[model samples]
Target: MALDGQNVCRHHGGNAPQSLRAGERRVTEERARVLVETYGRKIETTAAEALLDEVQWTAGHVAWLRERVQEIESEAAVAATDREHPLVWGVTREKSGGEDRGTTEEAAPNVWLKLYQQERTHLVKVCSEAIRAGIEERRIKLAEQQGVLVAQAIRAILGDLDLTVEQQARVPEVVPRHLRALAS
Candidate 1:
């Protein structure tokens, strides 16, 4: 049957047809509300799951890195031990012949000091060489610049004398000996 806006449904006794325009509007509104709620819940759930996974992965990586760091530290400590001879912190003479007992810490500082001194010596030599090279390069550049300035001064003198190119080139040969010596 063709149902209008106020038409009543047969199944609901006196209730209006849910398929009518007004009824459809209410249904559409409810459907939209449901969709928004479901979509929001799914988004929140996915974000929460991703965050948890990231936290788990980061914790695992940090734990692994920590273990590796500890292992490296232990290896370094063992390698730092001096294998030359047993240290003698104090001497003990009993029924036994002789025994030396001490911590290896005393020799470590001396070894490190020698290494530092050698490194300082190397650094000084390198720095000195670098400075010397820089000074030499600067001297060379300055000499070249001075030569250019001298040449320009000579050209200006020739120009002031109103000399042509040919005259300028021959002035040295035509000048008196005393004048040439004074110019030189």
Candidate 2:
């Protein structure tokens, strides 16, 4: 496969005339088909810098959306002062063809109200997702802190116990295996 100008792989035809880069490998369609059937597709997400940039951009976008929600000049509360034209209408049309079918039209409230609610609902969901991501990040950080303390305590205890050299030789191999979960 080849990485091309549009990020498309050459296996499916690259965006432009292309050639593989120095360390690039190609997978045959037959091998790829079998691999995909068993384990799904191979995709890339190994770029940590890209993920960080995306997170920053999303956070900025959320703040901007929040400000837009607050900064909107609402005409919702203001009563209609124009008495000259009162033929206000909200039209909805539906059609059905069957023995017992009828029109399915609905009369919704003002479009502005619907938009306001939709925007606010979207904001709530995005805020919730951001909050959960933050909490997971913090939880991982705390676990790392605790893992360090545990390692230190284990070392200190080993020092206090005055174990034999043969016994000391076994600790390094055993400790890391047990502390693996906390490292993440």
Candidate 3:
């Protein structure tokens, strides 16, 4: 569908009514064309940098949490073995019949299981928090980059229009009589 000044201007009907002059409208259209042509390349570079920053920030936190969980698991395994072979680890006592022997085999305690589970849960929480923080940081960076890209595009457009100021100032004189009548 085609858009016209009437439709575009309707949004600001109540406050400080304003309209784009013919030359200004041409310049604005040129600016929009330039932005469309150049914005993607600029945004792509910015987004890549933002993503890298986020990855760098999160990598260390993730590695530390993984190492901690691995340590916890190793300790839990050792504790389980100790519970099963108390004599093997020198924790057994001799029986009353003067026979040197080991104690009955017992299953690993529930406390060890609980501790392992808790440590695993904490590790997951830490990893998740790191990921969320990374994502948030990346989003912030991307938003900032997008703002810079937009501003750069505007400046570029202004610069191009500035170079054509003299030529653009002569457009109204070339306007057709029919178009001028319609404007009136």
Candidate 4:
């Protein structure tokens, strides 16, 4: 592509070496600024808040996978009738070619169960990274900091939102159960 605000093509190296470096630096900076503005406008969360969000998100996902795994196992215990459960949840590759094939074998529930367990394990590992990083935020390991962080995050969220009376009531019953998953 042509260089921005310049006559030469970017890939052809027609510009002098020093000018090319300066131009590349300008482009890089401008791109970074645009990205910051766009992302900042969209979410506006600090790094700490982002990590906290990721922890909650991963914990919620792990909770869902646990329930799904139990259901799959329960189904497997009885009869082996259904077989269309996906190998990967939320994604399936399409054949992209011409006509659809009529006959195709499907994965059994045990396979899906194992996949869900693996996903939950991976998600726990992801949350552990966030937890460990939080523990190290002070340059010394503070194993109990996860609880404090969770408490602080909850306080921050509840403090910021104007919840209805019902919503406020629900927080006590709801938040602790999901937060409990992080300990596991």
**Highest TM-score model number:** 4
Overlapping backbone residue pairs in candidate 2 total 0
The Cα local distance difference test for each model comes to: 0.54, 0.57, 0.54, 0.68
What root-mean-square deviation over C-alphas does model 2 reach? 16.3
RMSD of 4: 14.2
Where in model 2 is the C-alpha error above 4 Å? 1-136, 181-184
Residue-level lDDT tens digits of model 2 in 5-74: 2346756556434434321334455466778899856466544433444556666666665555444323
Question: Least accurate stretch of 10 residues (summed lDDT) in model 1?
Answer: 85-94
Candidate 4 residue pairs in backbone clash = none
Sort by lDDT, best first. 4, 2, 3, 1
Candidate 3 vs 4: which has more TM-score: 4
TM-score of 1: 0.23
Q: Which wins on lDDT, candidate 1 or candidate 4? A: 4
**How many clashing residue pairs, candidate 3?**
0
How many collisions between residues are there in candidate 4? 0
Ranked candidates, highest TM-score first:
4, 2, 1, 3
Per-candidate TM-score against the hidden true structure? 0.23, 0.30, 0.21, 0.37
* CA RMSD of all predictions: 28.1, 16.3, 29.7, 14.2
**Residue 130 error for model 4, in Å?**
1.9
Over 1-184, each residue of candidate 1 has an lDDT whose tens digit, in order, gives 3333334554543244445657667667878889888875534455334444444555555555555545644655676744422221222222433354343243232333344455555555554554555644665788789867866887688779998789977866765454557668
Best by lDDT: 4
lDDT, residue 4, model 1: 36
